[model samples]
Target: MASVPSLSASIQQRVADALGADPLLRRSDRADFQANGVLGLAKRNKANPREVAAQVVEALPTGDDDGLIAAIEVSGPGFLNITVSDAAITRTLAARAADDRLGVPLKADPGTTVVDYAQPNVAKEMHVGHLRSSVIGDAITKILEFEGEKVIRRHHIGDWGTQFGMLVQYLIEHPHELDHEAGETAAGEESMSRLDRVYKASRKLFDADEDFKTRSRKRVVDLQAGDPETLALWQRFVDESKIYFYSVYDKLDIAIRDEDIVGESGYNDMLIETCTLLEESGVAVRSNGALCVFFDDIKGKDGEPVPLIVQKADGGFGYAATDLSAIRNRTADLHADTLLYVVDARQALHFKMVFEAARRIGWLTDEVTVKHLPFGTVLGKDGKPLKTREGVSTKLEDLLDEAVQRAAVVIRAKNEELSEEVVAARAAEVGIGAIKYADLSTSLGRDYVFDLDRMVSLTGDTSVYLQYAYARIRSILRKAGDAKPAAHPELPLAPAERALGLLLDEFGNTLAGVAETYEPHKLASYLYSVASALATFYEQCPVLKADTPETVENRLFLADLTGRTLRQGMTLLGIRTPEQL
Candidate 1:
């Protein structure tokens, strides 16, 4: 593999030689790059288009720059419409094949990023909504890590607040609810189901009975005061929730570290001090006897200004208080240069106010970047927010389980030779990949359908398609046996090979954009393009049955590179591409 010049660099050199000075280069449908600035250069120099273009062409490097510039023509209105050769495309792809990192460079100035995601409230059921946050956040984490940036994951689970009080009070009344000998319960199912039942019963009683509500309220105060018994009960609720959350994450094939989970309760101590910092700075003022920050742009239907309440009139800290404190800790204490909140789109207003308040007090300055990656809802087939047939929000675990089961059916039908264990493992990958890919393939701000059939289908823009493409490439390589993949520089290029090479060279450039935009969907789109191009190439070019050994080796090399690129790209998107899938 020979060294390959970057597309942008190559274009810039051609333009400079042809038109002189800085020339704007962009991808176009008409040509590789339409140098519209050529006319401007002629205007400035008071010369004709042909003469200006001739000088620039003469200045273009000769010997080594042969195939890179196929033709540089002076088009309508003095536009320098340029077209590149297949040789240039192949050389660039060869360069990418030489690098382990796929020719992608790390950011020049990477910073520590603290991301808040996967926040399901403690002692409650996690719905499909939580899936969006976890899936999106996980993809972002992978992409950031690929760019060689430091990423700190914070689950920000809702493990504290008045709800814990109700749960604790109920547990105190019935101490045997969450109590069961280790072996008495089923490995994973029975334990979680029992906890779920107790939680529902406690919630019903707490809501209907006035006396029970009062006791629950007092339990909150006791729990906050570090009452030993109440604290122990609180711990049980958290432990049970973790078991359930872990099961869901496992089914999704995503790893969530135990130590990284820091819920709202974790920021309890800093809440008061955070409020004090805001008040002292005059960033927060007392509104209706409650500490709040009002924004001129945020208004209700009645046209009254909306305020983000830091502290309620009853002296209780709400969600805002905890998040503001978290910002302070992440920036001042953790030394994070980038703060990312991957939450539901519904909480956009809360984050907007929190970020504004954080900036006002200097907790977040111009030097620190804060972003709220707000994602839209997951709708059912009816285009409404996803819910069970009975109208209740579906549990995250149940949804994932069903998706995996559906995937198993597809896998069994397609590949009968796969062992039971492989089928099971592949089912989890395909199911979870379907869900995560569905969320990531689209822009983060839009609603997407949750359809298992569509996700597991072998065709279309699904993970199954990409995985299958990868598996096919691997199979081809295996069939090639000991015949090594050696690039044949002398071989002529086919149309499909040229297209694949051009797309392959863009891997690094696309990743650079993804890192800058914080958009994994862009990377997803790029991977889909690579797979699509490979499919076309496979149909056009013969690998094992080629006319010559050299052509066979070159085609095999191309297939090997495509497989590696697909596998690596899918891994970065948090999707597994099984070699035999």
Candidate 2:
């Protein structure tokens, strides 16, 4: 299929090139599209509005079969309510059906994008807090890649800091602490279990024994100083943590590679240099023995300036220092045109200051743009942050497992004869997709409630609904023996056929917008609208049992295209569509 230029875009360009002004075109509620730019253009040129609209209308290309614009009426001042011909819609869709891209165009000038997301801490279980970043970031990456953008995934896990000193020192004391049986080490869950036990024991000893605390603090200094022994011990913790991270990612069905697992410690070598550069450049000042970057507009509760501390007074580097160094590596070394930090919304101010500080140091300049794609917390049904009865954070694995379990029940009811293995397999797809769809259905900046009941339901905006819609279409096509889908643009179309065709024609335009804005929710909403229109079409227009063979084939063509569109869209969002119920 070839890339199809949208009807609105064609008209807008025609109007703009003719009048040499912005077209300001919008999809009309009552008409196909409305061009409201003539009113402004007329005022600017000191001409009559209706007369200017007439000139713009005359500029439109005229044709009977291939002409994009069918009717253009200039009414009420200078508003041009335009309608595209049904023939044109069918013709464009025919082109789309012939291409693998489904008529979506690759970016003319694609650039590198580094996405930082799915951060988890060392020697700890992943919680629901990390869910949004992983899901949203995966979708964004997929969407960007589909658009031909060079996407780099950075896990940015929490695999560094003074805490490692305690774990390492404890491991040193108990040399076989992290060592498991030959069979056990192969399992990620078993690896996590060993780490959790060691972590708890280390923390308990570090807190209770005075001498151990001194040894642990000294280990931190040794680790930072690059002592081979301490550094080697720290590496063990990092490697072990990745095992757990990979397991959780696998369960979620996200493909995370080992090479992309760059944590905070990845910037360790450059931290000191980063601080030195800031101080030398005078972007940072030594205040109370700490290197700090101050902003006039940023203040504390006492009306005093709150500076970003690059280094503590105790001669230790802070997160800001590590992040500044990361900017240099990502922008200068990676040659990334865009840097995206998919972090928590609470870190907005920290990123603002960090990015500003990076700009001051000339690391992030005109050639590169950075954005902290902040996301809100996932709340429970009670409208509070999700947590267990003991107030501990809900484990991400547990949440995912529950979703799959609930989906199995739904699948079982739909098909009682399904084997346990098949039911479980389909359940994972539906359950995982439900969680992802619900998260993406809402705007990235808004907090969303996590309700498995709503997410796994067969109706509404859930992914299950979309999945079933695709499956139903597949079923219809399978049942139509020897009835191949064939397009007939010359045949008169019912209103339902016309409506579905118009919506299908907008796929390229809709995806282009979503990819450009880095907003997956927009794509989700667009897909939902397409699915809804498809439902209406199916109900009103019979495919296999139509009165005539040509009409049946034409309706089947519409159904076939709709299924392909849904599958393509959902795949971009990291969701799977099963062929059966």
lDDT of 1 by residue, 88-117 (tens): 666666777788877777776889999888
Model 1: lDDT of residue 247: 71
Best by lDDT: 2
Q: Model 1 — which ten-residue stretch has the worst lDDT?
A: 182-191
- Any runs in candidate 1 off by more than 4 Å, and if so which? 1-5, 13-21, 40-51, 62-67, 184-188
Clashes of 2: 2
Compute each candidate's TM-score over C-alphas.
0.94, 0.97
C-alpha lDDT of all candidate models, in order: 0.83, 0.89
Give per-residue CA lDDT, model 2, range 165-261, as digits (tens).
8988998999997776765545678878889999999999999999999999999999988999998988888888788888888888899998898
User: Cα lDDT of model 1 overall?
Assistant: 0.83
